[model samples]
Target: MDYLLAILIIVYVALMILVGYIAWKHTSNSEDYLVAGRQSNSYIMALSYGATFISTAAIVGFGGLAGTNGLGILWLVFLNIAVGIFIAFVIFGKPTRKMGQYLNALTFPEFLSKRFNSKFIQYFSGLLIFLTMPIYAASVLIGAARFVETTINIDFNLAILILAIIIGFYVIFGGIKGVMYTDALQGTIMFLGMLILLISIYSMLGGVTHAHELLSSMAPLFPESAKVTGATGWTTFPTTGSPFWWNLVSSIILGVGIGAIAQPQLAVRFMTVKSNKELNRAVLVGGIFIFVTTFTAYVVGALSNVYFYQTTGQIAIQAAGGNVDKIIPTFINSAMPKWFTYIFLLTLLSAAMSTISTQFHVQGSSIAHDVYCAIKNRSSLRITRIGILIAIIIAVVLAYILPGNIVATGTSIFFGICAVAFLPVYLCALFWKRTTKLGAIAGIVSGTVSSLFCLLFTYKKVAAGLGICKFLTGKAVLFSGMPWPYVDPMVIALPIAFIFTIGVSLLTKNSKEEEIAIEKMFKAEEGA
Candidate 1:
């Protein structure tokens, strides 16, 4: 079986290499490397967007959370479709595409910088993404590596290095074109693998009705530690305003769900398409893809509790030995047939690779295009590839150092920070013609500072984990209370960001030159 699995993996890697080689052959200039030459069809655009949006973070990280936290996490699925896909496409996507084209922006930082006419905005945002995005990338790497370690009986460190090197090859050589082409293939595999897993889980437990009933009836078995944190059951919501509820609603659901709109990696996909028509056509595909994948992962995760309890007289968390990051992987390996394990491994590999490839690409562009080129007033595809290599190394190192059960927490931390730091500025750029460069700068600064302060000083999970608050204040968290520790940083910081952006814009004014550029951007929107 190990030999057979090795052959399957080799075939998969070969296919990815073939695709990457084709993309590298087609890629000639910065335009092709950065935005896939802005000629993507709706199918490719949607798949790339969806695949980049959902990753090991969704399948393994959040899926494991669903096992530990119960079905309450399902709210994220609704928000992912409604906000991440629908609102993002219908409201934000068209304008972003149009403005990006008008500005000739190849990257998200470039898009903002060109819109506001600020080199500071470009380089600062780029620097921030370059430095901070590795945490999210590392979390995705950890998710895939954990699965590989478990399924193949390989050393965990080796799995991380292997996945990183393979993904880095295509991202560095083929760029955005390579990333998207492979994304389409991986997204298809994820959708089908998840569909099969969903069907199999249900059928094994006597179909959906019986499976759900069994899970609901086992509410009494909810872990004591989880109950203390306010988890109610496998099929019901947590106690409102409890720590569990706050984590679920604020960090897990709202963090990734609403934060998806402003992600540098995902936002760049809007510019990959030629027109709003492709964005429009992609809405349904993106929506369905998110729904099927997320819904399956969450449901299977919750149902795994039932499976474990029946088989080993243990709840999901206990069955997986208390690591929330391992529940999904553990459940699959323990409950499924060997043949299916190979397929699911491929599914997870596709998920992790698709997301990490886009992340490395975005990080590389942040360095070479937004920071370096903005400073030097010159472009270099060579520098971009070098930047990608650096990004991969940073992510792999973090993957090694970070503790276990960090997948969901790390994902939310990055997503929440992105929301606070970028969402307000991104919205103002897209919608508010009156937004000024000073306002944009102020917004970014305030949001970033406030979020980091909260994470290091007030958010218990992060502050305690980092030991920063303890070292500085002699407390686990600044506020040793119920809601403050539980509430996500985005809850406090995002509103501050929006207020600063709007208030500062009202006080400040754009220069005539900047005004002319803004007018042209709006005109582009009007034409679209």
Candidate 2:
């Protein structure tokens, strides 16, 4: 059985390699490589964006998180549809695509600098993308590798290296078009796999009502060993201050929910589609994809806890003993038929790699288009390829060195940073004329720095409070509470970024040239 699954995995990898090779033929010029010649249709954009957006985080990480949290995790799907697809495209899509067309911006940093006419904004934004995106890429590695390790009982590090090489090869060779095309294929596999898993698990449990009742009655009524904590059985909502509730509302739901709009990898999807009309088309497809994908995964994950607790009398705990990242992988490997587990594992890898490929591509573009271009004083394709190579190398090293649980912790940090760092400046550039170069710079710096500060300080506070924080200051003694004071870093970072953009814009008037540039790009009426 295990051999069958392993063989299926090998086949999936080969198919992906073939896809990458096919995409290779499309990449003669930098424009083709970077933005797909600005010609991706809405169908590709929808599936590709959904694939990149949904990753191991959605399936493994969020699934595990949802297992413990109950149906409350469905809130994220609401946001993905409402904020990520609907509001994002309606509000930000037209302008973002318009700007991308007007300025011929390939990357998010390029969009910022070109709009505001600030070389500094471009350089710093590029630097942030290069520096910060690796954490996200590493998280994808950890999440996908965890699925492999848990499913097949392979060594985690070996799985990480294997998965990294497979994903990195396609991305390094295939670039943007390869990534998006594979992302669409990956999206289909993930959607179908999760859906099938959901049906199978439900059938095994004897139906929805039976499963719900079983899950509900298991926790408190069961033995002490089975006494539900985290995601043992999501029969009911958390008993106040439960890690389940806080994590669902704050970390999973709020963090990824709002974080979607400003994501560099996802943002560039708008540029791929040709017009505002194409973007509108993406909304329906993208919304349905996100809803079904997230709903199936969350339902299966939360209910899998029901299956596990019923069978084993305890939640499937991570051997390293952390949160629920290990839950869905364990559920699949242990509960499902071996053949299905193998099929699902490929789907899981596809989910992670599709997103990982996009992150590397975006990071590469940020370096190639924004930072290296500014530094070298020319947009050289050779320089871009060099930047892409450097980005890949960094990702490879970080994927190897980054500690395991960093996926949940590290990914949150990256999303929070992008939200704080880019969203405000983007809003300002699109809407406000008074946004001077200095104001744009200040907003970005403030948001990026403050977001990092909040994360660092909060992590320290939590570690110290847990009595585990060590090295250097050793957990600020004053933080007596268990988690210290870690809120979503976005809460702090986002406000500071906004203030800098709006406050500074109000204080510092834009030059006539800057104003003219903004108006011409926006094609706005005087009041608008």
Candidate 3:
């Protein structure tokens, strides 16, 4: 079985390398490297976007979470379609594509900088992406690494190191073209793998109704520790008003859902296409892709609990020895046929690599193209490739050091920060001609600082698990006594940033020239 799995993986890796080589051959300039020369078709763009957005975090981290949390986590699946695919592509996609082309903006920060006519916005936003994005990138690395380590029985550190090197090589060599081309392939693999896994699980558990019935019947079997944190069962929502409920709704669901709009990596996809027509055509493909991938994972993951309990007399979480991160992979290893296990492992690998490649590409562009090239007034493809290498090293180290629940933790933190810092500014840049430089700057600064402070000092995970704040505060979380222990920072920081952005914009004014630039940006806006 191991030998057969290795053969399958080797074939997949060869295919990925071939794709990277093809992309590298065609990538002759910075434009091709950054945005695929803005010529990708709707199919390639949509699949790449879906693949990049739905990463190992969704399949491994969130899937494992669903094993314990129940189908309620499907809210994220719904939101991924509604907000992430529909609103993002249909509503924001057209304006973003138009303005990005108008401003000659290849990167998200560059878009903001040119739209607002502020180098400060460009440099600062680029710096933020460079500095803070690695944590999220690391989370993705960890998710894939864990699966590889468990499925192949390899060392965790070794698995992460190998995975990082392979992903970094292609990303550094092929750039966005490589990332997107490979993303389309990876997305296809993930769709097939998840669909199969879902079907097999339902069949194993005697179909959806029987599986869910068994799961709902085990509500009384909820672990004592979980119960204390307000876990009612795998079949129901977290206990309302409990710490777990706040963590689920506010931190996990809302954070990632809202944050999807402002993701630097995902935003760059709009600039990769030629027109809104591609985006419009992409909506259905992207939506179906996201739906199949996430809906299947969450349902199958939740149903895994029923499968495990019946087969092993142990709940999924308990069977994995209390680490939810291990539940999904372990369940597959234990419950599935050998051939299917090998195939599912490919899906896991594709999920991690697609997302990780995008992160590396985005980080590379932010540092090299957005920051260095903008300042130097020259673009160096060599420097961008080098930046990708550096980012991989940093992310690999972080992935090695981070502990359990790293996927969800990293996703929430990055998403929360991005939402707070970029969402208001991004929306205003697209729709509001009155968004002054000062307002944009103020909103970004306040949002970044507030979110970071809360994440480090007020969130229990960082305070305790990371120990960054324990030295000063002598407690895991400074706000441990607050109404909700794990409420995501977006709850507080997003509103503050939005209010400041609106208030500051209303009080201040844009120059006539700047106002004209803003108006020209939206002249082709479909929804505006």
Instruction: Name the better of 1 and 3 by TM-score.
Output: 1
Q: Candidate 3 on 59-142: residue-level lDDT in tens?
A: 888888898777778899888999999999988888888888877888999999988899888889988998999989999888
Model 3 lDDT on a 0 to 1 scale: 0.87
**Each prediction's TM-score against the native?**
0.99, 0.90, 0.97
Q: Considering every candidate listed, which one attains the maximal lDDT?
A: 1
Q: Rate the local accuracy (lDDT) of all candidates.
A: 0.92, 0.77, 0.87
- lDDT value for candidate 1? 0.92
Q: For model 2, state the Cα shift of residue 18 in Å.
A: 2.5
Which candidate has the highest TM-score of all?
Answer: 1
Could you tell me how far off, in angstroms, the CA of residue 352 lies in candidate 1 after the best superposition? Answer: 0.4
